[model samples]
Target chain A: MDIKSLKNYLYWLYCQFELITCSYLMEPWEKLLFYTFNITMLVMVLYTAYIFVPVHISTAFQFFLHLLGNQHENTVSVVK
Target chain B: MANPSAVCNGHLHHHHQKQNNLLKSGIYKKNGITKGMKKNGVSNGTLHKKTITEHFEQAPMYVAVLTFLGFGVGTIFGYLRDFMRAWGLEKRNVAAEREQQKDFVPLYQDFENFYTRNLYMRIRDNWNRPICSVPGPQFDLMERVTDDYNWTFRFTGRTIKNVINMGSYNYLGFAETDVNALKTVTIELQKYGTGICSTRQEMGSLDKHVELEKLVAKFLGVEDAMVFGMGFATNSMNIPALVGKGCLILSDELNHTSLVLGARLSGATIRIFKHNNMQSLEKLLRDAIIYGQPRSRRAWRKILILVEGIYSMEGSIVRLPEIVFLKKKYKAYLYLDEAHSIGAVGATGRGVVEYFGMSPDDVDVLMGTFTKSFGAAGGYIAGKKDLVDFLRTHSHSAVYATSMCPPVAEQIIRAMKCLMGLDGTTQGLQRVRQLGKNTRYFRRRLHEMGFIIYGNDDSPVVPLLLYMPGKIGAFARRMLEKNIGVVVVGFPATPITESRARFCVSAAHTREMLDTVLNALDELGDFLHLKYSRYSKSSHPELYEETRLELED
Candidate 1:
């Protein structure tokens, strides 16, 4: 056989192994849909985390600053 | 339950019809009638055919999910702990070894053994329990205590005594062969001392070795036989001597690692068939013949099928009848390893061939070990005289390793003599029959207890499923506490969810001893909640029946 045909044959042979009978290996359309759902879920998680984490971290930092820095300033200036 | 053979027969009927279609398609030339075609083209009549029943209980769907999830969560946590250790947030008391070895290129690669440090270490006490006595009906395990999380253990110098041995592979109770073969030991030891101090290929070939080989060949009903000092080496070394570059080896997926190594060393094109699945084997054989050797597209010099008579871990017998049929039809060589089944099964302790009433000539290569059943050390390769002659000159074990010791050979000779009734006693016959009785009774009782069991009822190697990895150690330690020793097998030797406690029922075990083990499992089953099989009707019929119906609902 030609190199291209042999490569195609080998790839077909590789796909014969049912890698994920538990949840995966399905009809092409169903597999495509399932993979779309998975990729979407991953993207949504990444987007939500990207939108939430830094703001939350900064807010928490502000709160901690009020607890430590404000108390030190009030004690030196107002209490004295 | 009414007729167990019906289940297996139904399976065979389905396969027969499916393959009949394939046969009609003209892929097969001769001997294609797989079900009942016997030697010399004799068609199987009703009296000539027998159905061998084998049952393997599948875990419930939820159990599989849980096992998969458990493995995943365990892996995540393990990697997280590794990250923490890397960040110096966690400290291990067992860093002593790594710290000392940090000098040169880190000779011992313990870091790569992630499973050991994380999962295996947690349950390390269940394995390698030092036994202080002969592994007969009962033995003593030296007690050990681990303070630093099984990293280092200090033996307490005290032994747990009189524990019922449910884990040893003394199938014919020939483990006491030393005691039984005492009469012959004097002459055996006197003539050829204890050790050979030489390899068999050169100076180590003693008179006893020659006699043992001849006797082995006679016993197996083969042309010739060669014995090896090590059982593992028998496969790992001899296989390469048989097949090489231009050859093809179709090995069972569950074949012993020795066979795998040997197949790799032989430089043959190796293909794996699904374990004991004839359809998968047929597909592979067809594909192999069609494809020929890869790249070159040249016909393989030879095609060999490697299978085990009884898989040690799985406790299942190979479907030998069908394999032989397939081998004959496809013109491939058959290699049968009867290491666990040789003296453990069959009517007269011949092996799976005798168990199935098939002739030994059907197999091209017959290999077996004396370690399990003969109460001796070493293994043998029995086949055509040509194979033996070739192996004698080429096999690395025969050429390099020390020969089988004199006393061990004597022990084996005595065991075989007794088994063949040449010793003028029915003791061997009795042991073989007793083993079957014990195996069946034990399996049935365990089945009735509603526990999930694996393998055929006739197999002496009984593996009771404990899905949760935690239960592997729990069942083992609890059984040890109850004075019954059992072996626990778990990941990564087996799949994560398929962890099981294996019990090897010996002919040495009396009815009462078996009863004691049953009682222990009965109590432990409830305590561990391991009785997950709703298929079986338990002793308490009404109670289990109600539960079964409720679950079905």
Candidate 2:
């Protein structure tokens, strides 16, 4: 993956991790908005990866993004 | 403007700005640098939903750990506080126990030392004795008699056989172990449990209380009777309950302590007459009527005359007919305490009124106790229904104390029944008659032997005069050596020089016992160097009185 892709993926992973961890400490409005934004960004990253496009995302960024996505799914199911 | 170096530098600057925005929002703002970030146009973390979730995640784990630590520390501190308190109490208890042990002394030695130093010296020196003294003259006399007579006064674990109880107030010997009476008591105990916990006004009173009162009233020939915890309490409760602030009490000087306490508590004006002196009583009565008037207007209410049916220490009977005559003449209420008379005097052992054949109505109030002849504890006052009704409401002692245990009341009832002839009238009368005969025989025999006896000729109490106060101890010691029990009463209970040994005769005494006691007395007279011839002369000095005539102008 390219540096630009790596940086964007890293930003997305950081947001998802922050949204899940911060949810316990945040008020309900902040927690809901952050969670929705992370979910939208995570779907966009996964769709870009699945389309076989020449994505510029780096290996490290992909690894972190995958870890955040799995954690987000687990947290959402627990809340439901 | 398309310079390659400039374009690259611009791209690097834009990328740095975006990364700085993300880092400022995530790291610096979340780490609480709101003031610095807000100045740089970065929004403060106004995310309410995120903050709430954060608080929930932190509360559970933090609260659990803090609460558990607090509880553990508190338990340890609480245990340490309790241990320190218990240790302090143990130290205090040990000190108290050691002090008590160090001070302990035999009661008899203490009593003797107290009496000799305090009582005997005061009497010998002609100083007035206090009302209650330990080693008082009276106790000295008792000790002297016990020593001289070789009497065994076994205080602990007393039984019928071990005791030759000359100090007992059981005048007629009715308190003797009667098989039939014991059976009655046992039957009553089986029927009723041991005690009733409430006062008479409450559920504590039982049918036995009513029955005992009824029997006592009938025996005394009065309208009714109200029971009390003791004979002393009867006077203490009834007197104050009956008379109030404006009333006057004319008391005989020799009336029992109960009467004195009762009168004092009543807040009444008390005038004491000479012992058994009706003239003095009449004078006091006349004076009260004349002087007990209010300065504002009319006279005060009539006075009350208080006397005992029998003077216990002197063993003298009250001149009841004269007292009744004076009561009627002055229109005063007469209150009689028959503590020592009932079950001992009168034809049927009905006490002073019966002994004198006077009507019960003549005496306004009559009180007696069960301890003497009834072989039980407690007392009763017999009077008109209204007076008893008033006392039931006002008597403080009655209202405050626990009610009498049922077994004691039952015993009194059975004893009263036995005395009044539920068993048989003939048997009861026979016992009383025998007691009268025994008293007469004992008194006559002692008088014939030249002993100066105190009291009326028919009285059961025969107080032998021992004249020399100093010899009281020696005389008592000799008497005790003979295994005959008698009490010596001297100063305080009696006048200093009037010290004497008081002998009580009971119906239980066999003829052999009387003979044995008389023989011992006769032997004691010689042993103590007492001259029998001087007894007649000293006891009857009136025979030597010379008549003188006075001239009037």
Candidate 3:
């Protein structure tokens, strides 16, 4: 998932291997199915990030506020 | 303080003379004369050039991967924090942030300070650490502590003493004034107080300023030179004076920010070539000549090539010989900035020109700063008399900015005299030789330790790559805790994965001192998993054996 290994992997795919299955072996219907699956998966990940992050962040914020309520001045100089 | 070093310098000078005689006679194959100054000397008239910069090696794949992953995770966390603040789930302590402006648009964007709050805050203490002594080989850093996740810091009333200063650009040890230079500086102080409070172009050109300029011209082997008050302004102001409207500036992409600002302000059409890549430069030069200016199709008013003697961040020396050839072929003007390399480079310390065994006339403009190697406050431009004459009236630094301080000028004069052997001693030679030796030894040791470092092996700015952003702060903190000062850079200044800690090796560093710092680095490397190199320099295969599976494999 890191940039460099991904680059090397792509370089290997582009230089050493031929795109046989996707370019030649796949039928029109299968190709359409593959494209649909990829598009849907990417959209789903983006959608989850859009919807779930706010809730997770609000909970974390509430916890932080609760944790720092009473001894705000002392904790301000002592801890995070 | 000075006598022992003078004695050491005398011994080294004699040894150098004996080796020089042998080298000329072809008795020896050039081994110990100087590590990085080998084969290229003013005595020899040719430069041995390299295609790609050799010493700046790439790190192992894992370091890059880990760095990106850290940044990605950090970015996601940053977004989450931003969302929390924007949606009012988390409230800022500031009263203004809590106030709502009814029937009006919000004045501030919530994510405006996202990078600062989310990313930089986590590791902000690594930089801008205040030091309380002369930034020589050893200095004192005032310690401070932070609470509430680096939102603010308060001084702890403690100073870290005897901290080995590997972070400063005091290359020739000029920042540390010895007894001899101190006496002369005091005399100059009485004569000229601190500063003249006027511009050189107005009334501030004193005897000391004139003498310093003449000495600088002689030291650089140029016809004339002009002094300026500030180093950054030396380029940012003077470049506009030289080139403007429709002029083409073929600048290196890795050129300094000052140079970038100067080029932009010049109102010139700037074309960038890959750093030190002669092929890319040649392609640009050819296209520029063929294409000429935009729309109208006339030739550019002038083609000026801008490059630095040694790029400070990358620690790479300019391919000056090759660049000169390209300049001559394209009939372009050459502007060389030796800010970091002036008194620190070359066999005779004349800079990149002397290092390449090329004549001063090979370069059209010779620009450098006294702030680095000279350990003074200003900069200078030296070339032909015409260039200096034109810059005298036209350059903003010369015309508007106040003249350089008198004592600073005297310091530069004394330092330049020592560099040119006018002080009737070889201490300058010894310093240059020591710096070259220190640089090579330091780089060789880092390479042997399996740490990836950038720049020429001879260049004093040794950037040791830490790669991981997390390790950037970790390395600096650990080194400080071990009583060593280091400078680390991440993100904005460099590509995220190329985060590094740059060690500016100086002639002032003793072998024992360097070894102590190296020992600290070795322990840190082991703990931090920083040994990322697959190759080792000549020896230390055993060191590589320990990190092989953990790193490259």
Q: Distance from true position, residue B385, model 1, in Å?
A: 0.9
Candidate 1's residue-wise lDDT over B99-135, tens digit each? 6566767543463377666666767888998999988
Worst 10-residue lDDT window, candidate 1 chain B = B1-10
Of 1 and 2, the candidate ranking higher by DockQ: 1
Q: Which stretches of candidate 2 lie over 4 Å from their true place?
A: A1-80, B1-163, B293-298, B529-553
Q: Of the pair 2 and 3, which is ahead by DockQ?
A: 3
DockQ of 3: 0.01
Q: Tens-digit lDDT track for model 2 on A1-80?
A: 69998897777565433322323223345457656876999999989778755455565667787677755677778878
Q: For candidate 2, what is the interface RMSD?
A: 47.1
DockQ, 0 to 1 scale, candidate 1: 0.02
Q: Estimate each model's TM-score.
A: 0.76, 0.60, 0.77
lDDT of 3 by residue, B1-553 (tens): 1332243343323224333432252432344334324443323334463333456677767556656766665566567666777688875533233355744665544543565576677678888999998898988999999865566789999999999999988999988847766788889999889998899878888999999998787666567898887999999999999999999999999899999999999999999999999999999999999999989889998999999999888999999988988999989999999999897877767787766656676789999999998788889999888889999989988878889999989989888877766777887887888898788778878888888888887789998887766677678888999999999987777776788899999999987899999999998887676777877355554443443344333
What TM value does model 3 have? 0.77
> What is each predicted model's overall lDDT from 0 to 1?
0.79, 0.61, 0.78
Q: What docking tier does model 2 reach? A: incorrect
Q: What is the TM-score ranking, best to worst?
A: 3, 1, 2
